[model samples]
Target: MPKADAESPQAPVDPRLLRYASASRGFFVAIAAIALAQTVVIVAFAWLLTRAITSAIDGMPVAELAPTLGWLAAVVAVRAALLWAREAVAARAAARVQTQLRSALVAAVGALGPEWLAARGSASLAITAGRGLDALEAYFGRYLPQLVQTVVATPLILVVMWWQDWISGLTVLLTLPLIPVFMVLIGLATRSVQQRQWQTLQHLASRFADTVQGLSTLKVFGRQHRAAASVERVTDQYRRETMRVLRVSFLSGFTLEFLASISVAIVAVSIGFRLIDGALTLAVGLFVLLLAPEAYLPLRQVGVQFHAAAEGVAATEDVFAVLDAARASKGSAAGSADSHSPVPEPHPAVPELVEGRLVVRDLRVHRGGGMLPPLSFSARPGTVTLLEGPSGAGKSSVFAALRGAAAFDGTAELGGADVRALAPSQWLAWAGQQPGLLAGTIAGNVTLGDPAPDTAAVSRALDLACAQALDPALELGVQGAGLSGGQAQRVAVARAIYRHLRGLAPVVALDEPSSALDAQTEARLWRGIRSLADEGATVLLISHRTSARAIADTVVHLEPSEVPA
Candidate 1:
């Protein structure tokens, strides 16, 4: 994954987000239609209002000017309505884009798996996918539409100005370049500042989230104060960073507004000179002045909104970088031909291994700066196998390798074919060292992502994992917070068992399955686990406890491998 760095302020628009934006073409099309109608109304309103006012100044009778006044009123009313419709369209587009981008971001992160997510820090990812994407609302709703307006409206108004009087048009043309030049200079200077602000935001979010998640542990160890102090420090830093971004924002907005106001002033001065010399009529001078500000308005709004959108842009860059990393890692693992495919098909299934033994021959996993000594073992059908090892022995590494969560060298076979060649969905059900439960009902955790979760199967798995003690309807806090350690582990085990019971997979792997259980609960859990083996499913457990050996059909003891100099 890409490490946090000061991203270039001038980084190009992310193609991923652009692709998502493109998918909402209908929304933009509606917006464009409205903008076009609104632009025409604005120009007409200016011309009609000018004509009526000039006639009034010339002492035209009220009765005679009534028709012109009525036309102006009608134009103003249509312009107001179109303006409302344009805003409504922009809001709808913003919402659609935000929802689509957030969903895609989350799905991509999930497909990358736990190992990749952990490396990036979950809190940071959460904030990016949640709040960071939300910032795009300002971009989509305000900045982007105005940008389109500047493209469409500015030129149309400028042509009208030039047609009215060549002198006023010449003055506007000379000053128009100044607004963009100032905007560009200010953007270049503040891009890095905004990038840094976003990085600090992610860091603060990561620290705060980790602290909250581990609050109980910190309180038990009487270090909560220290954690609080650290949080406060980070929070202060974030505040300062936020202020810096605000300062830049205020500066940019002021600069763009000031430049635009001066440009309008210059146009006003030329129009006034022409009017005094009788070279221009009162109506024409007033029309040119009104249109002058309109021409610069869109460009000025773009500059202002661009600063607001900078943080979202930075977050977007980070999200795409993570996605790119995931793609690269997957590509490397699958090799060239099937590399880009997220999931490749296993080699044609061997019928003999379809429901047979899992065999390993010198299966060495590369991890922690060294290779684990070649492991040779066989897990027969209808047997429970325990992998016993000291801390740092690469036991979990080996387990992950067999499950295809990590890459390894040497052969691992089921029946007679290599394990890597077998479809993992056909055989593997894994419960990690910690219970990875979302905040939901116990039943929901047991059947996460199951299309049609069966209550009977859930109850059976709960009983088998000794987790029936937990009420099926009980709600767990985030990360299974409300449950005790043992209960949480049991719930995780139940999840694997639920999958097994549902016939999704036949082999179950539990990492430190009973580490939090008391002797009695541990025994009951293992007995339940062992029963699976007796019922013709392969069971693999990783543990360091000596008591686990008593129930295991085979115990393989491994010592930590030494790192080579």
Candidate 2:
């Protein structure tokens, strides 16, 4: 399940939103200032139009009326300019906020590491970081400004209305609450449905991405048609959820419109009767009547904009949850540091185990809320230590624990330091079961993370990894698509070798590096692994092939362990 799968419709503006995306804070202040100016302009425009109309009716000379008319026109233009300014500010602010939130989200995910992300599908996260943040434009640009307008304009308009005509002011005051009452009721329904709609969209994206990624396997098993049907089903469900959101939005719009119209009508009718009965002056009556709709307008709009912003609000909940998690993780680390807490080792080590040796004693790695059975081994400088095991025997889990992706109990030390105390990049040059290659020249891929890549060393690393046939200049597509699996695997090994040989890392850990190679290539790769050990580099090799035994200086076999219930 998603972490922030629920929606909160209560707060008009989430405080956490401003905290995580600091770009939006100044935007609110700017929008508030603009809203204040707009409220003043709205009143000026109404008063000038009233003055111009009353003067013309009294048959005032054309020359005298010209000034009022000119002022009215000027006020109209200023109001138009203010609207343009608000939109410009909102657009720019929205863009800045989106960029900030996306950056924070990506960094947070990196800090959390791949082990935390394994439970969350990449498709859902992509949607959140991409389309999810994009929807904030409506919230930041349109809905938020209108909401501020409502906050600043509505009450001020009502106070002006009361000064001019108390009866009309009171009439508006009585009916205005109806709109929000309906809004609250309708917003409750909209929040639930919009949340579901957002979740369904995530589900659809995950379904489509999963199908495309595994299309080859589906075809091999003759289940491609079934996978297509599953994607279509999810797509249809998303469409239905979208339609439901639209219906609620339309309903909310109709409700607010109906209530606002009726409220304005009530105020208008009362004003007209007062004028006919000689209870009100013409100037005041006209001014308050014009001001009546303006008073209710912002509230009605607030109700409407609330629905428009609902989806964005939902997205923010998820974005904020991720950010909050990052903050908590940082705080925990800080707390641990203050309390003199580093990852503790389970036993008092033999003093001789301090330097150069990669030693593990009774290490149990975490696996989905359970622990793998304890195992222990060591690899010294200039030796290939093989971790051999069957499927589900926790071989890769051991590598994961070393790299900070999985938590483990017990001690693993290298070069006189705890593995947990050092950054993985400082000590381990690792390649996992997956090639994990990005789109780039093979040279760039091999020399990844190197500040100044050595051209000569790139070639040597390729040769050492038995990837000499692959050119350094060869370019590949996303995930190294141009190369065959064996070629990509060799390139991954070369990356580890390049890092190690450059003295950038100490332990070269390879997981199933020859899984895709033929017997001939496998033999050559084995020679390269042996050569690295011969050069006084510590090599941790994980492979199932019995052929791996010939090169191993020490073989530690992992026994099959069942996942705990």
Candidate 3:
């Protein structure tokens, strides 16, 4: 297990935040315009209210009220239109940012490679890529623009209030700091809650994913009830954590709302006293009273939305954690290898040519808290080396070491160059006992990441693997679900053979490649392996079964340790 480093730099701030902040420029401007429009609407409505009240007091004609009422209604209509536009623009901006974020995340994960992925389980990744990112919708679509509006519009509203009446304006301005101060305190408290919530979510997701993946195994072993109990325990913990977060969230919102309400009431009382003293006109006093709540409305909304969005920000931090881990050493390793020597040119197309000259001298593997013996072996071009050993004699460990699956001691050399020093994309292909088949047509899986293979090449490889009976055009189903074990192995062989034909690499290491096959099918598989060697590729086969030994140019045997008697 890898140890966490305390001194290591914390994961960088989420790229989504940066992307959102940048993309939200238009959204912020739109919101500012809407707020300004709303202010005009509020002032107009106040004017109309004052006009009617003063007119009633002075005994003005009732017919004269029509124009003022019409103007107030128009202001409301225009404000409604601006609000619609603002929402539309903000939504568009949010969507654009989300797309960019998802793309960046996918690219970052791709760069991390299988080793980092192995350390971080697929369930955690699924959460990050799936529901984890969904959390950001609120952060981007709602909270972000409101945050910007609060920063810009709050000051402007305060300034307008001061212009109309300094006392009420100063009251709002003085008490305004209390809202955010209280918010900051609550935010600090909620941070820990958010972190715990996110952790629980990851645990739950991982447990659920693992359970589903192992459902078949549990049923076969008569352990479905045990699996359900495990899931129930995890879900119960998740429930407890969720309740904790919600409790804190409700408390934060209640506190902020109570404080904001008090501030608004203080402003209202001050305005009312000024009106009673005749220091302020009725129109101005009512306007100030109405604008007090409007001014703080965005900030108040932010407090509530902030609690909802904290989970998203916390999850975003985890997403960045995965991306940072993936890209960590990729640059230095790739750069150092590239700077050392120019890559060799590809060999000309030939039916068969010996290229791989693998040399393993003093190779050692450390795994499961034990160090295996120093392993030394060689597989020359056009030779199949059958590696045979007892169940725990490290035969598969040798395959892993050759293919760079785990870190090891000593040197593995390919054509006189250290294998560790070789770029991973160079010189090796590995197939395990259970070959991994993604969901796709057989031809697509066979080609893997290569450019789509032509019809002829696909046909030839399938025919060679004795999978001609399997349609290349048919979908393989999830994990090759529709195929038998032997069929899957044969397709895997076809994939390796396809890569070999493409000249992508010169060596192949297979761990129990024919383990699931019967005698005849195993024979056909070994015949294909021999043909690969005959075609100038170095082949390393790991299996305990003796039948696979026939095609090997050499057989290396490993013995388990016991007291020598």
The number of the candidate with the highest lDDT is 2
Clashing pairs in 1: none
Q: Would you list the rank order by lDDT, best first?
A: 2, 1, 3
Q: Model 1: number of clashes?
A: 0
Model 2 off-target regions past 4 Å? Answer: 1-9, 337-355, 561-565
lDDT of 2 by residue, 40-120 (tens): 999998999888888888999999998888888898899999999999999999999999999999999987666677768
- Assess the local accuracy of residue 190 in candidate 3 as a C-alpha lDDT between 0 and 100: 73
Question: What TM-score quantifies how close candidate 3 is to the native fold?
Answer: 0.83
Q: How many residue pairs clash in each candidate?
A: 0, 0, 0
lDDT tens digits by residue: candidate 3, 285-339: 8767777887888898887888777766766666666555555656655665678
Estimate the TM-score of every prediction: 0.91, 0.94, 0.83
The numbered model that scores best in TM-score is 2
lDDT of each: 0.79, 0.86, 0.73
- TM-score rank order: 2, 1, 3
lDDT of candidate model 2 versus the reference: 0.86
